[model samples]
Target: MLLAALIGAAGAVGAAPAAEPNTQVPAGSRHYAASGFPDRIVASPAQDAGSGFAVAWRTAPLAQPPLLELAVAGDSPDMGQVQQLRASSQALQTENGDSQHHRVLIDGLQADTLYAYRVQGQGSWSAWQHFRTAAAAGEPLTVLYFGDTQNKNLSHVSRVIRQGWQSAPDARLTLFAGDLVSGGDGEDDNEWGEWFAAGGWLLPGMAVAPAAGNHEYFEEFEDTPQERRVLGKHWPVTFALPSNGAAATASTTYWFDYQGLRVVVLDGTSALDLGTAKAQASWLEKVLEDSAQAWNIVVVHQPLYPLRAERDSSVLASEIRPVLQRHKVDLVLQGHDHTYGRRADDGASLPQYISSVAGPKQYRLSPQARATMKPTAEDTQLFQVLRLDDKGLRYEARTATGRLYDAFQISRDAQGGKRFSEVTEGRIPQRDCPRPVSPKGRDDRCWE
Candidate 1:
């Protein structure tokens, strides 16, 4: 069923003609282009919270079977005993060239343990990277979150991701609210490579949870009657996610429990525009209802309350918000507005909504955002660090240069009611585009 959904999502966009071997490669991106050596390695959490995890990577078609070497990290530099596990590979043909993607799933490990692993390239092996499994339930945990990195991933957004890691080096999981790349058509392999290069070793060291953005879906053939939006080819092979989501959405929409937090990822692009809203909503209700973790948070690409006045995600607002409100979700991390807006929960029922951007792209804040969000910003690239524990949740937003831009805290009462408060002592001044004196060309004043 998973395979079928993946294929369907890819094929639904439109079949592509065979690629010409002479496709032009973008400048400065050749260093990241796929080769015989392993690249784009990513680590993801398995369904078994504390016991297992998965890793995926890309390389040219291998002449020999791929292998993954794993061992428990110890004080000794030498890996005393290593377990060699065979990996499965699938051939993927993109505009850049033909490459093979490999994935290995490791299970039956001890809980809350640190493990070091490396993958076999063509003739050599990659440097060993380390990742720790989720701690036991109800333990303190830290997480790093980012909004859309849809453009300038290599040159600009790279700093934001590295700064995020520097800010929370011990963070267990890194969550991306989608639009990781700008290419809507599935064939833009260079953009994907730049994205991986931007993350470097951090992607493999921390578990990743990603949601799908609309930019991840595009029409293969534009302006034709047969044109239909479909999922990108790089998505399925880039990250190995848990398959415990709605059947229709498969790997793109899923959830995993990490150290007392139930992090649910939804496919807003698939749900709102692709006719899977009801399925996702139903599955979400069940997931929220059955969550046994101390807190529940959702990650989606599209914001329920959009930051740009011209944008409207009415389907998501109507179909998904009710379920979240009914379940009393703690927080929602979102992207797609290319701006920053954070709204705390009202006295009544809405969960805290935050829309942010990590890439160079920016947009103007809408009137709704100006009125509701306390400290909205435009033309700013930001990253967030979220720490959750028995005491409460602490969230801090920082600029690309690693300055504190915004801070907030959420504390829960004995009855599980949440109270939100802002930390404005050391935060930088709020940034917004100045209104143009001449209204004729006002649209060109801010990032649009």
Candidate 2:
């Protein structure tokens, strides 16, 4: 196992219990509170290709009038020459406290140029950070993909993300397939705080493209009786995503273009609504039809094909699968199953679908789950790296310690047909929960 693989999940099974699922404010969470310093800084893709990018951060409630300073860097940038812009801000109230979230969209940037920028609170400014804009088409790229990072966020889950970044430092963008936090309704600010802490500086350095998982949506108040789950209130203030998706889904359901790849994110939670489902399905088909990128990828929270033995998202699958099939999406990545699974489309020429988890939470595999998923794993946390080359795309799933657990390659032909092949080299055997020392933990085992 690689050193990185030794860090989380596999090793954390014996650690202290994770935060309560409904904990909006874990004990001692005051230590994690935001001060005058800017935190939870994140970079997201601008609407278009290379012309722009967006950055967002949170500050103390007393902090007002968010500001962003940016400068184009050549051999070196002169800090004094930086241009300043007032960012748009929104007020949010969470269990942690009241604070303002700010986002600034820097436009008219030269493509492929290095730029330095920083944010400011009421009286403090963050250290300068730098990022490179996307280049034109045909540039080879590597993208890091992570599944549901929804538990033990600060201590354990953060390592999973850091290890992934350490392994693929040059990756252009990071795709988080949702369930970013355990409880998304802002009931638990600690989960969000931990999530932000886990990323540290990496969150602002690399652009994050995230999907909305079930955890990202919750009943507004934990005490609400028979309340329908909705997109968490924090989502709008937390992420500044493209607004090119369905009107109902907006930021949570959006798409962006990087180099030659077009990535579309959909809200699986909304699919439960018949009206919204049809609208998203229609919008998806239109987006696919309009896309000119060489690659099209779809990301959603619930797997169209569930990986659990007793669970299935057939309604969502029925609504979206046809659109995916008609569009010939290259890949479909998902979360919410809390297990690892991969299945090719029925025709084998359609999208290659996969679902995985990346937090300390673990689930067992049943005979039905085993029978449905060809390559599946239980009680394991994993991260995947995908490299897009001239010929095709190569994917590898590795443990936190850097052990290779699963891999495959998708090759595209001159006729636009995709050929999927599993790369068995360096792949580790599927993992099952080990026998526990305590009889009370038997239910957690992946194997009987």
TM-score of every prediction relative to native: 0.89, 0.90
Global CA lDDT of candidate 2, please?
Answer: 0.79
**Backbone collisions counted per model:** 0, 9
lDDT (10s digit) by residue, model 1, range 338-447: 88998855665347898999987677888887998867898888999999886688889999988899988888776766786778888999888654421234463254
Count backbone clashes in candidate 1. 0
Look at candidate 2 and tell me the lDDT of residue 423: 94
Candidate 1 C-alpha error for residue 233, in Å: 0.5
Q: Tell me model 1's lDDT, rounded to 2 decimals.
A: 0.84
Residue 391, candidate 1: Cα error in Å is 2.0
RMSD of each: 10.3, 4.6
Error of 1 at 440 (Å): 17
- State the displacement of the C-alpha of residue 151, model 2, in Å, after optimal TM-score superposition: 0.7
